[model samples]
Target: MKPLDEQQAAARSWFESLRDRICAAFEGIEREAGSDAGFAYTPWDRVDPSGEPGGGGVRGVMKGKVFEKVGVNVSTVGGTFEGEFAKSIHGAGDDPRFFATGISLVAHMANPHVPAVHMNTRFLCTTKRWFGGGADLNPPIPYDTDTADFHVTMQAACDAHDPAHYPRFKQWADDYFYIPHRQVHRGVGGIFYDHLSDDWARDFAFTRDVGEAFLRIYPALVRRRMGQAFDDADRARQLEWRGRYAEFNLVYDRGTLFGLKTGGNIDAILMSLPPLATWS
Candidate 1:
């Protein structure tokens, strides 16, 4: 693989910086809860048959008094897409070469009232380049205020770029996150956008704003409800909800499929799964 160009390097750097900020905020939450816990980062590399250097990522996770389990990962990788998958990627029709950088996060709170959430933002290039990612809330016990706050933040981010972006992506999230087999939506919707085209500079700006929106809004919600009391019934609900989350991620999520297809580290790819989940 060739060296990363300026755009790709910048995207990767920003993602790493975002990961650091998010981990710091979550650790601060743990500190407020009087837990000594903080994130532990493990680095991993990708395998490419051509002996090309396919860049790697760091998997950062924290288990603490407030956050039950959270994984925040950032990676920048360059390589060729394999066989059938090549046809499906944007610019890989003839040339399967690709470069991608992004951050992905999934958080499951210790308290059921404190919602679980997922956020990811990525920049990918093949023959063409574009940005993609969004965040969503998954509360076993929903709060109207929390849902509204989440959407409000995301909407503001989108509207700043294109007025149509918020409604369009919010609906995209509503559609994309659905579990058709289970006949249910994943959670209270946030926003999901992919292939945000036009130009790299503008698309990157919007992507940064989306990350900022999540970084600002989600920790606030977590702090608000992390101390709430819950009983066994609530615990049971959270577990059952985790079951749904696990199902969607393993079966329907595009990111999960992408990671697996690209020979990503198995443990980091599977880190989105809840620490504990129950079905039926």
Candidate 2:
């Protein structure tokens, strides 16, 4: 693996900082809900089969009155991709060496009305370097207002970079996040993008704005709906929808596949799974 350079170091620092800010925001919400729950971090390391230091990261999780369960993971791993996997990854064909740094989050709300969400942004250094990630909202009972607010914030982030970003990425999210077995869209999608290349500076700036947009909007959405009342029916719907979420992540989510393939921590890789979900 190539020695970590200044760019990789800078990206890794930003990811960790984002993780801290997000965890603090969530802990604050927990406090507001009268629960003392705060994120408990567990650090893990990865070693190549050759026993070389591959890199490592920390997993942060919190369970509380408002956030039933949430996981924020930051990992920077470097190693050669295994035999067949090298053919599939960017920049690994010539030499299987690679490095990746990113922040991933999954929040499952206790209140059904407060939609569950997923967000992740990453920079991967293979023979190629690029940025990828976006956020999506999964509501048991969809609300026009909430969906609109989420998309509007996402659009502003895209518009800040390029006029074409929102429309392109919005369609990309709808297409990428679809569940073929169930033949349904995963959620009222936000945006999902990947393989964004052409310029590192511009792409990195856009990726940072994407995270900023999520931080700015998601908590406000949580505060608005967390207080809303929900009955048994709503709870059941949330569970059933969560089943769909689990199926999609296990079957189709690229991030899940990437994590598992890269020898990432199993718990952190599967952290997107809701604590409790129903098939029916």
What lDDT does each candidate get?
0.93, 0.92
Over 158-277, each residue of candidate 1 has an lDDT whose tens digit, in order, gives 999999999899999999999999999989989998888798899999999999999999999998998889999999999999999999999999999999888787888899999999
Candidate 1 residue runs with Cα over 4 Å from true position: none
User: What is the overall TM-score of model 1 with all chains considered together?
Assistant: 0.99
Candidate 1, 91: how far from true, in Å? 1.6
Report the poorest 10 consecutive residues by lDDT, candidate 2: 1-10
lDDT of 2: 0.92
List TM-scores for all candidates, in order: 0.99, 0.98
In the range 20-113, model 2's lDDT, one tens digit per residue, is 9899999999999999999999999998756788888999999999999999999999987888888888778888888999999999999999
The per-residue C-alpha lDDT of model 1 at residue 78 equals 81
Model 1 alpha-carbon miss at residue 104, Å: 0.3
